[model samples]
Target: MYSKFLILLLLSAFCTSCGSKPETTRPVTGTITESVYASGVIKGENQYQVYSTVNGLVEKVLVSEGDLVKKGTPVIQLVGKVAMLNTENAGLAAAYSRISANGERLSELENNISLARQKMNNDASLFERQKNLWDQKIGTRLEYEQRELAYSNAVNAFETAKLRYNEALKQLRFQEQQSQKNLQILQTSAKDYIIKSESEGQVYDILKKAGEMVTPQTAIAIIGDASRFLIELQIDEYDIAKIKIGQKILVNMDSYRGTTFEAKVSRVIPYMNERSKSFTIEAVFVKAPQTLYPNLTCEANIVISHKEKALTIPRDYLLDGGYVLLQKEKKQKVSTGLMDYQRVEILGGLKGDENLIKPQ
Candidate 1:
């Protein structure tokens, strides 16, 4: 009986030793902020890629990276040999088809018309004289009939000459007008070879080099406002609905380590990126860094809510389904409020001084 009793005592002590004390924490009064995390890059205001409107060999890169530019400034010149040749050919055609250049042809038609008019007049006078003589019974009938036939032929010839002159004039005028329009079109197309800046800003990058072939699909350079910058962030679709314009943002960048910058959400893109399943948002700096560049990487937290002096405990102290363990290993449910990475605010079911055990 004593042996069995000693075995029982030893088993009790072993069981007690195996059951370790659970870790514990008490609710504290402090500030807690609820925020949504986002990752993004810094971009210059109005940044965009420059593309050529026409395909050609890059004749020269007119502006280098980091150069200040004005609106309508020529940035890149393309080799436009073919376009130039076409323009020149069009100009030649225009000049050759001008009314002045074809004046000799028109003048020849006019002279024919004038000569036909004189012949018609002379034949009519002869026919009138022959008729008078015939009526007075002094001329043969054959002579009067021949004069009448000659006058009729002369009148027909005159009308045909006038018609030929008018048709020739109309054809010449049409040729001149068509050639002018073609020349204008070719000249406008030739100007496309010179790529110009669409905005006044700094040149961030020159993507194409001299002697490189570029198409309308290829980017020629990068340009944007040099003095202003903004943050472009991608928020997860799950958290996107929580985001709103004018929300406060805390920004951190690898380039500027150990510093957090203040910013505000300026815009939210309504559309979500299907491939990434994220929504894009933009923010402007409240107090910007002195020096900034386009495409600098950054991460940000958008503040959703904040509470000052709320009863809070470490996040690990709360178990699944908002339950916490008491000193006697009793489970108590708590209402939650604002939460951060480290702490969560307790809204109910826990007093300010309760000792809560962390979840195993």
Candidate 2:
């Protein structure tokens, strides 16, 4: 009978221990932060791909990857035999068409004009002398008429010579101007064969080799500012509305593992990326890493709001639809506020001293 009583006692104890005894904890006063998550890459300021304006075989690459360059620096030289020949031909044409080159021809025209004027003056004198002789009754009528006709012919010849000289001078000037303009254009075009950097920066990549063919459409190199860098992030569409310029951002980069960097949003691209279904935004580093390079992958969290002291509980303890389990398996609804990955803010229905049961 004592053994039976002992066995009953053990069974009762086992059943009692197995009965539901839920774990519980009270809410604590702490800080809570709400933020949006993003992921993107690092880009140097003013980064851009370099392209040549004309088509040619690359004869030499003047700048290598990681070379520092100034604005208007020569980056590549192209094989421009045809361009050189065209320029030379244009120069020769310009030289031959110069007004000074036709000095001898103009001199001949001037000489003819002078001769015509002298003959015209001589004819006028003879005609006057003949008229005087006829008036004095010492010359025949035929002689007077002949002298008048000769004077008229000499005047016409003089005018014709002057007209021819003026026309020749005008033609020469026009040709000179036209040829000079053509030479200037060809000279500018020849300079296009030497590709130059458009901005002051460092060359990050040289995309083409010395023997590769390049056209205006081909990018020959990549360049950007050497010292300045920015973070480019794509924020999901659901959280895009929370993003704003000047918001604080916490950045983590793969290159700098375990280190968090602070940055601020500088720009928000107003357009959405159709493929990614995300909005693109840019941020400038406030506390930058010692060394940074272009195209570094990074993850970021943009802080939207924060509270230093709030009644908060672990996210797992809170049930869906804003309810929490209390003692005796009772459910009570709670008004919530700002939340993060691990915690949720309880604004109402739960005091800091109440024990909340973990839901099974």
TM-score (all chains, Cα) for each model: 0.80, 0.77
Q: Relative to the true structure, how large is the alpha-carbon lDDT of every model? A: 0.94, 0.94
The segments of candidate 2 whose C-alpha lies over 4 angstroms from its true place after superposition are 1-29, 128-149, 236-241, 269-279, 310-360
Model 1 residue pairs with clashes: none
Ten contiguous residues with the weakest lDDT in model 1: 351-360
Error of 1 at 187 (Å): 2.5
Superposition TM-score, candidate 2 onto the true structure: 0.77
Tell me which residue pairs clash in candidate 2. none
Q: Report lDDT (Cα) of residue 53, candidate 2.
A: 88
lDDT (Cα, tens digit) per residue for candidate 2, span 151-236: 99999999999999999999999999999999999898999999999999999999999899999998999999999999999999
Instruction: Compose the digit string of candidate 1's lDDT tens values, residues 1-360.
Output: 999999999999999978978788889898899999999999989999999888899998889899999998999999998999999999999999998999899999999999999999999999999999999998899999999999999999999999999999899899999999999999988988999999999999999999999899999999999999999999999999899899999999988999999999999999989999999999999999989989999999999998888999999888889988998889998999998999999999998788877777
Q: How much is 355 displaced in model 2, in angstroms? A: 9.1
